[model samples]
Target: MLLRKLVPVFALSLASAGVSADRLKPEDAVEYRQSAFRLMSFQLGVLNPLHRRQAYDDEAFVYRAETLSRLAELALEGFTEDSKGQQSRTQARMWDEREAFETRLREFAETTAQMAERSAAGDSRATRDLFRQTLQSCKSCHDRYRIE
Candidate 1:
């Protein structure tokens, strides 16, 4: 709900700011992607307690899930050919096996979006299951494509 409204505003702000993805240097793209992932990691911190049933904040969880979903959508845009050789945890195989790598990213995006929807619907069980799938997606990609 809030995310839906905020997204257009965010896009308009970025556009007005003249933030051109294509104009970014390779290292800039690497930094951009890493920053998104770092935020995603921060958002994921809520999952452990929620999964354990020790804590549950519906509003916060929904917001974080939606934010994570949006970040997943943006993350892959940073994997440009120009960014391939930048110093990062990204592996050469991400480029060598671009199709497979991208497929994994899409999977992550899908899982996150589903989790967000479930969270918004107040379905804790489904949200928790989807969250685990989201974590597995991250682990899968990291195992296959990240250096460490």
Candidate 2:
């Protein structure tokens, strides 16, 4: 989790593992937030079909869940700035209701982390249930705090 602490610092200079070369403007911050979520979605998305089809092996599920957990960590960091610009769906309440937003964000992150642990333990049922719980938190937060 040392990486987590370093992300916001690197974000100011806007550099990480070949991610960005230029300094981050507020608009760039907005893009970073969106891109982080998109990547999180993609990680979950790949496993979704396997979930429905019940076709994936235990290793795949664990790997994806672990990846999802890491991505969730990255996601919280993206919201460090009050980034507002065209195409940003972030509501003012993200900054205004910072405590509430962070409360839910932490809950979501913890849920994903739990999923990773359960998946790694070979508990597919618990992992899948945790995935639903995680998704629900995502929806609930977006419903109240995101712009359509």
Report clash pairs, candidate 1. Answer: none
lDDT string for model 1 (28-110, tens) is 88988888888888888876666677233377777787778768756776777888878899888788999888777766776
Local error of candidate 1 at 76, Å? 1.0
The CA lDDT at 4 in model 2 is 33
Backbone N/Cα/C clashes per model: 0, 0
Full-model lDDT for every candidate: 0.75, 0.69
My TM-score estimates for the predictions, one after another, are 0.81, 0.74
RMSD of 2: 7.4
> lDDT tens string, model 2, 1-148?
1223422222121234455323566676667768878988887787787678663345667667666766665666566543544456878777778778877876776777778678767777887788789778889999988888
> Could you give me the TM-score of model 1 versus the true structure?
0.81
Off by over 4 Å in 2: 1-24, 55-57, 82-87
lDDT of 2 at 87: 53
